[model samples]
Target: MARLLVTPATGALPVTAGGMTLSLTDPGCITSLAPWRGAGMALSKALRAAHGVDFPDPGRISTSGTTRCLWAGRDQAFLVGPAPDSAALADHAALTDQSDAWAVMRLDGPGARDVLARLTPLDLRAQVFEPGHTARTLLGQMNAVLSRDAANGYEIMVFRSMTATALHELTEAMKSVTAQGGADPSPG
Candidate 1:
């Protein structure tokens, strides 16, 4: 089996060559509503009144269908899409360009959550970590935004500077899990 190697700052982690692949990229097309500073109650209310759906609670929102919104922090939320319709959500809160400020790493493998559990405090058990669910938590002591991208994969977001460290930690965890030959506890 191909090993999960840690990449240097400018290097991209291999994403398609092994049991698990990690790809690092600059999501230039994405934008974050992170700067819209306000209380959660106000934002949720505005979103519900405007969009006809309740704004999801923090660590909740699934990324399945078109246009999913997630609470990235107490005062910030992130909208993920081929193109974020900031204007639609802007009517209720503030929007800012976070495309250039963050690095997105896509992690895919049967042991993906095993790698994540070592870094994040959130429970990665199948019963709890399901598709469309998201959580803003710390990964390897650094703030990270995570979402399950598929039944056996995840997408982890962190600041640009912390990317290398996050990858290193994840790689180590995956190795440990593979050595033990344990099945991933996450549900499909």
Candidate 2:
């Protein structure tokens, strides 16, 4: 039998143009952690002890080192960037491996928000969606988890099957922003 090789959801190389760069990112192990009903506080404590990150509240992203707990929905968060100690977290939340179910991409540059503004309806203005904030929103027509990881950087997660579409939309937006001389209207 021929061996099957694993490939990244998108290509491994970054696509860059006019100072904006979009690159596929490996966020280590991605675990979906849903706290048992009424176990939210306990889960947050246990997570902080085990991973040094709090189970985030809605629209937040908690971080400690490279590990992050991103609020994924009303009662769920994604434990990303390290292999979670399942034994430590199993008691408080339902832990499911989501390592291969999604594609992770990083968009960074001065024109990043401008590019994103062209694609998403959500306000990317720094005052409204500052660094460390996250949202479950539409990226073009696809559902995506968008996080502002830095002043001019974002991490976008989408279903693995939508990788190409996401890339195409983002690339087109980036091109348009670049063509417009990188004008950004969102206040810092």
Candidate 3:
């Protein structure tokens, strides 16, 4: 007998418009961590020992090798990386398995920022939202975690239940931006 493996069934979604590419991202093993009773220092040290990642400050992200800790909000950080382990954070703080609860995507290439600018309220510019910066913002009607992965790359995470709607809105926005840039219109 063999165990089973099931994915979210989102299939492979990659949209190319002009010089931009929007691709569904595979975020392996996402874990949410929230400290209780102001034990952030203790929790941070524990996480450092477990994943070699320094807990990030608010609006910031800390990455050590493959592991990344994104600031989810005040006193809370989302540990997005490989090798998911509940006990890695359970003792130090509250833990939630968010691996299947999010629909992650990346917008990269030349016109990535232009597409993002059309959908999100936050400034997606280089100086203001540079790499290592993270924020919770509105992506159309859905709440999304927006992170600047690089000057030309950005990551967006929205609730799994809102995946279709979010993708639709993002694709549409990308099309508009790319079309104006004289790139071929995105696929319908």
Candidate 4:
């Protein structure tokens, strides 16, 4: 009999091109929290009590300490980082462990937005997609959760099975952005 070991989606290493870098990020734990009908408020309260994070509005990401509550879609949010108090949340919402279902990656550096622009249709301009803004969007052909976690930085989450494809797409975009004289150095 042989034993197996778990591995990160991107080999747990950084990939760089044209001054930009992409790396795997361990968010600790990811839990899907879907509120039951009419229990939205209670779920929010329970989340606050458990993680100190408010339920996020559509297209927003809320954070407290290392925990982030991101609006995943209508009536659904994902709590990334730290395990939630399931007992406290069970009455208000359905809780499912999603830690192994996703591959979280961090993209950063000067031309990061430009690199992402090649893959997604959403506007990446800072004025429009400021830090803490998040969206359910397409990254190339895969479904992804995109968030502007900081200026010149983004957090991209996709299905664990699609990580290789995601990496290929982003790398190609990074190369293209680099070839096209690189990203504009101005802050927008």
Whose TM-score is greatest here? 4
For every candidate in turn, the CA RMSD to the true structure comes to 6.4, 2.8, 4.6, 2.8
Runs off by more than 4 Å, candidate 1: 1-10, 15-18, 25-28, 34-54, 62-66, 82-91, 182-188
lDDT for every model? 0.66, 0.88, 0.79, 0.88
**Candidate 4 lDDT tens digits, 71-163:** 999999999888889899999999888888888889999999988988999888889999989999999999999999889899999988898
Candidate 1 lDDT by residue in tens digits, 1-188: 12222245637466343377777744434445543445456656655554443456677763434555666776566665545455556655677666555668888877777777778999877678787678888898999889885787787888777777777777777777777774465454
Q: What is the lDDT of residue 60 in candidate 3?
A: 95
Cα-based TM-score, every candidate: 0.72, 0.92, 0.88, 0.93
lDDT of candidate 2 at residue 47, scale 0 to 100? 93
RMSD of 4: 2.8
- Candidate 4 or 3, higher TM-score: 4
Residues 26-69, model 3: lDDT tens digits: 77778888887777888898888888887798889989887899
Which stretch of 10 consecutive residues in model 3 shows the poorest summed lDDT?
A: 1-10
Per-candidate clashes, comma-separated: 4, 0, 0, 0
Model 2 has an lDDT value of 0.88
Q: What residue runs in model 3 are displaced by over 4 Å at the alpha carbon?
A: 1-9, 182-188
Kindly report the root-mean-square deviation of model 1 from the true structure over all alpha carbons: 6.4
Let me know the TM-score candidate 3 reaches against the reference structure. Answer: 0.88
